[model samples]
Target chain A: MRADARDNRARIMTAADDVFGRSPSASTDDVARLAGVGIATVFRHFPTKTELLEAVLTLRLERLRERARELSGDAEPGKAFFEFFTQVVSESASKLAIAEALTAAGAVAGAEAQEAGRGMRSAFNDLLTAAQRAGAVRTDAEFPEVYALLIGASRGATAAKLDPAVRDRMLTLIYAGLKPYA
Target chain B: MRADARDNRARIMTAADDVFGRSPSASTDDVARLAGVGIATVFRHFPTKTELLEAVLTLRLERLRERARELSGDAEPGKAFFEFFTQVVSESASKLAIAEALTAAGAVAGAEAQEAGRGMRSAFNDLLTAAQRAGAVRTDAEFPEVYALLIGASRGATAAKLDPAVRDRMLTLIYAGLKPYA
Candidate 1:
């Protein structure tokens, strides 16, 4: 793709992610308007609404994967792991909405999106390993447990529509649990 | 109600709880057989499948409420609180199934069941207060947070179809988080 075309595609992705994430029923025209691109350009990049959603989901997963990779190297391993954990939980509500929309539309997550998710999980494992090794987290903690906790915590917070302050306390308690013996 | 009639009703509820919880689509006849009662007895107690489910949900909630009340007097408040929390989560999968079955049948939890739920929540709050007072949980942990955690963790475990061992570890991590700082 040409540089301008790549830029337009990136812009379209950013807008679609934000738009569809917040309002799953948002239109491709909304994406076009948000991206400051023509409808033609939006369709050129994503032939269908489902395709656009798939692309957005893939981008979101890849973004988390990249963020996890970056955080894995932080000097404060525990903080890095947990901050990433919190970020993931906080973002999960919107991400879930997007996934649900896709499902409702009878579109399963495509292969590339699943691949990105696996990549994110792999990166997430690196953060978990570092935190455990640093003696910051409980040594017995493993990826599956952590992953389940994340899913649970995110779902819990979202379902309750918990106030941000209360959610933080909830997250704090979880962090306390994740830490090494006091 | 007469003693035998009350006994029959109780028996029907127990059987329905088990049957529909395990297989949401199980027939009323299955419940009758499980209760060792005649089909007429089951229908006499619960006129419809939805009625049976609602009754079971109320019974389940009341059972939890009673359990919480009993555990509140335990010598070890923390142990009681965490144990109840674990029990609720463990049973939530089945309870949720019943609830979903009710929803699928286009029946909402009846007012009595809703009352039982509130009563259970109140009892749960007492347990939380006792645990916090006993220094079993953090001082700042409020009912909403605990409730949200319970919800999140339960949904998470169920969604992942986590192995029993992994679910325990996840619960352990959550328990650790809820503990008062060392």
Candidate 2:
């Protein structure tokens, strides 16, 4: 796609994401309105509602993947893990909406999306392993359990509109649990 | 209320709870069928769907209050708090559904329901204070944050259908975070 065309598509997707974030049942017209584009332009870019949603999800996931990559190189693995987890929870509303859309549409064939999720999981496991090795995290800490819990908590944060202070406290508690027992 | 009438009311409420657990939107007839009571009898007792739901929630909250009371006496404060938190999370679907119903109907003014919620909160606060005094839980820990996080996690668990192992692991992480650094 040409640069202008690509930019238009990106604009449309971003607008659609914002609209859908507020109202999951937003119409293509709503997206077009938000993008200051015509409905025809939206259809030209995304053939169906599902496609439009998928595009929005793809954009968000890409951002998350970039964040994971950035965290992977942090100076301290424990800090990286904590920061990444916090970031994920904070932005979970968009991610969760996308996940819900994907599940509902049964559109699990997006290899790129799958890879993005896998990359996140891989980065988490790496951080966890490093933290344990450094004696920062608990010896009995299991990667899958921790990841699942984080995901669960993140999902919860999306719905409950949890206060930032509460979230910080919860994170602190989890970190304490991960600490090596004296 | 007479003893037999009270027993019958208890039986009907228990039966309604079971039916609602199976299906929150279950019909009044279904509740009556499960309770081994006539539909008219159920109607006579509850009067409205909202009333029935409130009754069921009151029962659940009452049981939780009882559990909190029992734990407060026999267990260490930290352990009791943790156990109560876990129990709430484990049964959050029922509690949350009822809470939502009560909030929606605006029928949460009954003395019994209010007392149950207040009693549980006081019990939880007592446990928290004791744990803090013992230097087990963090001094910075606040009751509202803990409650919010637990409620948030419980909501997430319901949405995600989180497995028991994953839930326990998350709780462990949370407990770790809640513990004092020293």
Candidate 3:
């Protein structure tokens, strides 16, 4: 695409993300307005709302995948794993909302996004394995269990609608739980 | 009330609880069928589905409050708190489903259920305070934080679709996180 067209596309995606986050039932016109673009421009870029959602989800997953890859090579495995866990929990909460909206809007994740998710999980598992080997995490810990804890901590934060200090406490508690058994 | 009438009410409530648990969208007819009573009889007792849900939630919360009070007087504070935590997490998962369903069905809790819930939370906080005083739980932990952890861990377990062993592991992991610094 041309440079101006590329800029418009990026703007549309970013605006759509914000609109969806603020209101799951956002309309294309709302997204276009937020993007400072006309409805015609949005349609020119993406033919359908499902196509737009699919594009947004794909972008989010790919970003996660990229971050995981960058963190994969860090020398301090324990710090790397915990940092990644925190990042995933905080970020995934909103990303998950978008994913759910996509599904509700009848826009299933295509193969590319599914592959991105798999890649992200595998990198996360690698970090966990390294952390466990360093005796930072409990020996009995499994990657699936770790992922569950991440989701749990995030869920806890949402359920409690915790204030900042309390949210920090919850996250700290999650980190403490992952420490090697006493 | 007559003995038979009391028996029928008990039966209807029990069956309603089960029906709502397995299927949040279950109809009153479904509940009556489960209770082995006529639809007319169910309506005679509850007047409406909201009334039935209020009754069920009230009963569940009262049972939790009773258990909490019993545990409060136990000599072993650590055991009491941890056991109560386990009981709440495991049992409340199903109860939460009913609660959510009730909300989705537009049934807000009546004052009675709200009072019962307050009673339960207060008892739980007392248990936590005792445990912390015993040096079994961390000092910084708050009641809301603890509740959030319980909900989070429960959610993680469900979202992971964990097997019993992994589910057990998730609970153990949450406990590990709750301990005072090693």
lDDT of 1 at A155: 70
Candidate number of the best lDDT: 1
Model 2 regions more than 4 Å off: A1-5, A23-29, A40-51, A93-119, B1-12, B22-33, B36-51, B93-119
lDDT of 1 by residue, A1-182 (tens): 99999999999999998898778789999999999999999999999998998888878778889999999989999899999988877775545553343223223578888788788889999999999989989988888999888877777765555787778888988888888887
Residue by residue across B54-152, what tens digits does model 3's lDDT show? 788778778878998999988988889989877766654544453342222222567887777778778889999999998899998888778767667
lDDT string, candidate 2, A1-182, tens digits: 99988998989988988888777787999999989988998899999997887766666666766777787777787787777777777666444564353233223636665565566567678877877777778878787667656655675555545677776776666666778886
Worst 10 residues of 2 chain A by lDDT: A98-107
Worst 10-residue stretch by lDDT in candidate 1 chain A? A98-107
Query: Model 3: which residue pairs collide?
Result: A177-B177
Runs of candidate 1 exceeding 4 Å displacement? A1-54, A93-110, B1-54, B93-110
- Model 1 has an lDDT value of 0.80
Give lDDT for model 3.
0.74
What tens-digit string does per-residue lDDT give for candidate 3 at A1-182?
A: 99999999999999987876666578999999999999999999999987887777667666766777787788888888888777766653544443242223222467766666667677778888988988888878887777767766766555444565676777788788888877
- DockQ, all candidates in order: 0.53, 0.37, 0.54
Correct interface contacts retained, every candidate: 0.90, 0.52, 0.74
Report the C-alpha lDDT of model 1 over B34-130, residue by residue, as the tens digit: 9999999888888898888778877777888899999999999999999998887777554556324212222356788778877888888999999
Clash list (residue pairs), candidate 2: A172-B177, A173-B177, A173-B178, A174-B177, A176-B176, A177-B176, A177-B177
lDDT (C-alpha) at residue B81 in model 2: 77
